[model samples]
Target: MLLNLNKMNDVKKTFDTINKIVADWDPLGVGETIAEDEYAGYIPEIIQVMKNDQSLFEYLSQILANELGRGFDSTDMKHVEGLKSICDKIIRAYMDI
Candidate 1:
């Protein structure tokens, strides 16, 4: 359906944005050691997208599952939880909008 396609496209765009942010922060990609300060700068941008796009949570959840499937460790899980917490805070802030 066209609606489903649009949702998928939105999710893909969000994922691409996340990938670009991570790549920009650490040119060597996710496995690289990025400075916490540098990485923190992009969290707002990601949270904005999640606040704007309802499909993003679903996409993010799937990505988290894939990462867990690949044997991601506790640190990765904590990072994911932190992101979800931020998303939750943003959602609550704008729930009436």
Candidate 2:
């Protein structure tokens, strides 16, 4: 139906926005030199957190610690806070749709 198609389009839009957020966050400092999908691997996990109403910051912290072999320290407080805000922003964006 047309309604379903419209909803799917909205979902895709949200996904694309989230994808850019992850890449723009650029935790690896690759900047625009990397492909747009460079952070695509994290998209599903971010979506999962949004769907489950879970804490993205916690999930991201786990990923950084286990997958990246790096963890935020006191000196990285700003980056940590930015991640937290991104979590809130994602949830709001998804719910608003």
Best by lDDT: 2
Cand. 1 Cα-lDDT: 0.49
TM-score of each: 0.31, 0.74
Model 2: colliding residue pairs = none
Candidate 1, 73: how far from true, in Å? 19
Query: What lDDT tens digits, residue by residue, belong to model 2 across residues 8-59?
Result: 9987887877887777767777777683567788887788877543467778
- For candidate 2, what is the TM-score? 0.74
In model 2, the runs with Cα more than 4 Å from the true position are 33-35, 51-54, 74-76
* Candidate 1 wrong stretches, greater than 4 Å: 27-97
Model 1, residue pairs in steric clash: none
Local accuracy of candidate 1 as per-residue lDDT tens digits, 40-62: 44445455566454445554444
TM-score of 1: 0.31
